[model samples]
Target chain A: MTSLVIAGKTFHSRLFLGTGKFSSNQLMQQAIETSGTEMVTVAMKRVDLHTPEDNMLEYINKETIQLLPNTSGARNAREAVFAAQMMQEIFETNWLKLEIHPDPRYLLPDPVETLKATEELVKLGFVVLPYISADPVLCKLLEEVGAATVMPLGAPIGSNKGLRTKDLLEIIIEQSNIPVVVDAGIGAPSHAAEAMEIGADAVLINTAIAVAGDPNVMAQAFKMAVESGRMAYEAQLATPHREADASSPLTAFLD
Target chain B: MNLKLEILNHNNMNIIINNNSREVAEGCTLERLIDEIGYKEFKFAVAVNNQVVKKTAWDETILYDGDKVIVIKAVSGG
Candidate 1:
């Protein structure tokens, strides 16, 4: 499969897994290995940082997975900016996943705040990847503001709803100059495959693998599915037909 | 009361806080201050002096004079 490159780093695997809600760190590690993911996401919080011996960090570092620190807790542009700066200092990397949501219940990304954060982050010498809704207009706005990638959610985060916004995602894929990574709410391996088949550069999954009975096996499944989907996409799928055509040709007058 | 306010005014780090300023003593742990502020309803993480402080270590961690404390929400997206 063709490698996926983002912000000067080439990723062999297009499936990016999230490190959260796993039964154990061992399971999480197994899942990461199984998925063959080159990049994994981790949230930045004061509590996790305080415990310098956090097993999550240790596990991820041992595996040599590239860490993508997310501003998951920031409510507004100012807070997100602050968190981004702190994360840069802590992680020693300019890469960040800018997530700004004012509402806590649904966890939908605030478009205005997200756009604002992306602009500021890009100016601050960070490789900004803003998480947003599947709004094509918002995606264009983010791209114009210098975002390295636009991570639009497929469904509500952790809901495992598969490509509910497929139409909008298609628009994003067609319009985007930068990479379009389908970020949240992807449940199964098939969902990852579908996203790739539709030309999504990458997909980030969390709950499905973390909560699975056999996370390692599931991770491996996802790995294969993503690769297969990417290969299919690169191969160029046949145009789909809406209705069956007559085998012998219904309009035979000309013939 | 007047002398304490005067001393606070002279301090460079001291800023006028409207809510529960009296509850802040000269030296109190972050845990104690958070409890006093009644912010337990919200899921928050604390950073003291530019360093992250875990919930487990909040009680043992003491707050000194002129320290900057930032309390942020835990799950803030959407």
Candidate 2:
């Protein structure tokens, strides 16, 4: 399987993990280790920079995992920008997961705000990875404005719906100049595998692993699934067929 | 009468705004008002409070009375 590279960092594992809703930090760390992820998404609000006993950072630090700060609560470009700046100061990195969903119900991204933020964040020297709809045009616009990556949701965040935007995702994969990391609503290892097979640079999972009966085991399962799918992709599976056909009699004239 | 005159002066500016209730004076530049609101620390885009104001232009543009001022933040993901 090909290594996923973003900003010169090579990641052998395409299964990126999220640090949220896990039963405990220990389990979260174990799951991350099992998943073999080098990068993990951590919500900006969850990080306690002042707390000496910050629990989450403890496990995360040992693994040497790169922390990707997310703007989960921000409602518009203004709030998002503020959160991003604060996160950068706290985390000491410009890498950000730009999210701008205003509505509390569906958590759908506001495209207008996302586009606006991308333009500004790029100027502010951020490696902006925006969470947006599966709109191909928006992706292109983000790229045009110098976003580092475009994270398109397969379904609503935490929905576990798994690749609802498969068709559009295919188009995005085909056309995108930047890496397409499929984030949100991935239900199972199979879903991660499917995304890998479709040429996603990476896949981020949180609720699926966190909510599993045994998160560590599930994390291992995801690890294997990601590898298996990536291997299959590299091997290039044969074209699918409908049914086995008997000797063709339609071309009997030529025979 | 002065408030009405200030409102009329603000209404004459070419900038677009999203929130008209801010009651900003006629000749106040966006930078001055943004500082006044103490929102400089918050990451945001100003639309004169409708049309998006580029960061570079924040200092140059002026706000008027009844102008809609839209302050937008970045948000996404459920």
Candidate 3:
């Protein structure tokens, strides 16, 4: 497998997992270990004083997998910045997945707020990965603002519609100076393979694996799919021709 | 006479924790507040009036009346 380097750190697996929507923490751990993802995202929430909760951090083996705490519920830059600071204190890792989507219905990332947060977070010494729409210009601007990576969504988050923004993603991938991680809306292994084949540096998956009938098996499948796609990309896929050229020895059967 | 003064102090020390009005003893620190709620065992971050209070500062950071304390921690997310 080819390596993915982001912010001077190398990741052998191109897959990044999200720690959410799992049937159980043990299952999530098993699936994560099965998938061999180098990084996983976790969100921040207020602890309910009434209920005793299980800390998911104990289940994740920090010795192997890096924790990427995200600012998921933050509606704007200020909230995001605050969350990022708390995440820094809790996780003790400067790596952050900056997501600012004010609209709850679609969870579409607010591009303006995302950009603003990225600038501030980057300045605060956080290795910022801003999730954004598949806009090439925005990707370029984010890169200019010192984002470690640009995570452009394949579709609306958790929608699993699969690469609704393929054309635009291609543009972003082509022009991006930093890694382009195709995050969100990847519903199937094929979707992951497609993103990898298109030269995406990596892909972040959540719903497809977490909500699967068998998430462990699904994670294994996704791992293989990502590897296959990346291999095909590295080997340089062959171009298609409009008309078929007679390259096969079909006439040899008669001989 | 002492019981009356203690009751009055408790009434005067009311603060909002996670948006719920509650009363704490006079000179209650952030550490004591979290310890009372059994959160000291867990890994969490606290913000007093929208400013993040580091864990090291929790011991000396005292809670005042009507103070808004937001305690947050890592949860599952994508």
Candidate 4:
């Protein structure tokens, strides 16, 4: 029942999937259907003239799923803005996943470029969801610049390390007023559950599912994990303690 | 033969599309070019020299010799 609302649009599923890394488009489609994700991220690329590919858009049902186009290969703000414009025209949606990673080595987002692009894209009427490092101040700045959501990395993109920035992400989640989607480096279903339990608005996952031994089953696992984590969060987990605590009292009569 | 070749050259111009050189009829509209390049069946957005061209304007926009045309479509990514 806890739906995620961004830019006045309601998303029933908090598990956002990335449409990448599948061996085939059919597998990707199956994974999406199995995961029950309402929001998915896509990237834009120049069409190959020699070998035009089957349009992947046909597989995605627009009525059921929301397309979130990303500026993944943009190395700077200018490129990101240009890609946003192109994406707006191609996808016919203003929902953008703004990522400006200049370095190919780590693929760490350039925070300065991300902040700059977010401000510009927001002004252009695009709902910007910026992928940034787990810097709480940067998250605040992005929020101030009218970003719809802040997607702080749990680890480097495609690393599968699982919440390496937990402490920083916790601070970001605690301080942020807008939705905080933990993106990247979430390798397992448990990681997704952990993220939700920590009160993340949502989690974006791709590599973990696409490369799994069985993507369909893995997708189902993630779906259940996200729901379970969200339910646990809603139920309010009990406080943890280092010392032993008795569940039952010792009665003098028994002694 | 020489006269025919001259006429053909005058009516056509070479343009760069997605980094490949191609011969399109002179003053060809972007819409026509898209059809010629087999992109009409696909969903895409186009830009000429880094400026995005709206779908509505594709019919009116013309391409010249050596002009760079970039057509982008949605691909899978995270």
TM-score of chain A of each: 0.92, 0.90, 0.97, 0.98
Cα lDDT for residue A169, candidate 1: 99
Q: Indicate the residue-level lDDT of A220 in model 2.
A: 95
- Give candidate 1 regions above 4 Å deviation: A48-53, A245-255, B1-66, B70-78
In the range A176-209, model 4's lDDT, one tens digit per residue, is 9999999999999999999999999999999999
Worst 10 residues of 2 chain A by lDDT: A46-55
How would you class the docking of model 3? medium
Flag clash pairs in model 3: none
Per-prediction count of colliding residue pairs?
4, 33, 0, 0
Indicate whether candidate 2 or candidate 3 has the larger lDDT. 3
**Prediction 3 global C-alpha lDDT:** 0.92
Q: Which candidate ranks first by TM-score, i.e. highest?
A: 4
Residue A136, model 2: lDDT of 92
Tens-place lDDT per residue, model 2, B1-78, is: 999988686555443333234555558888876676553334444565335576678799876655666554321112
DockQ in order: 0.07, 0.03, 0.79, 0.85
Give candidate 4 misplaced runs (Cα > 4 Å).
A252-254
C-alpha root-mean-square deviation, candidate 4: 1.2
Q: What is the lDDT of residue A161 in candidate 4?
A: 96
Best by DockQ: 4
| Superposition error at A159 for model 3 (Å) | 1.0
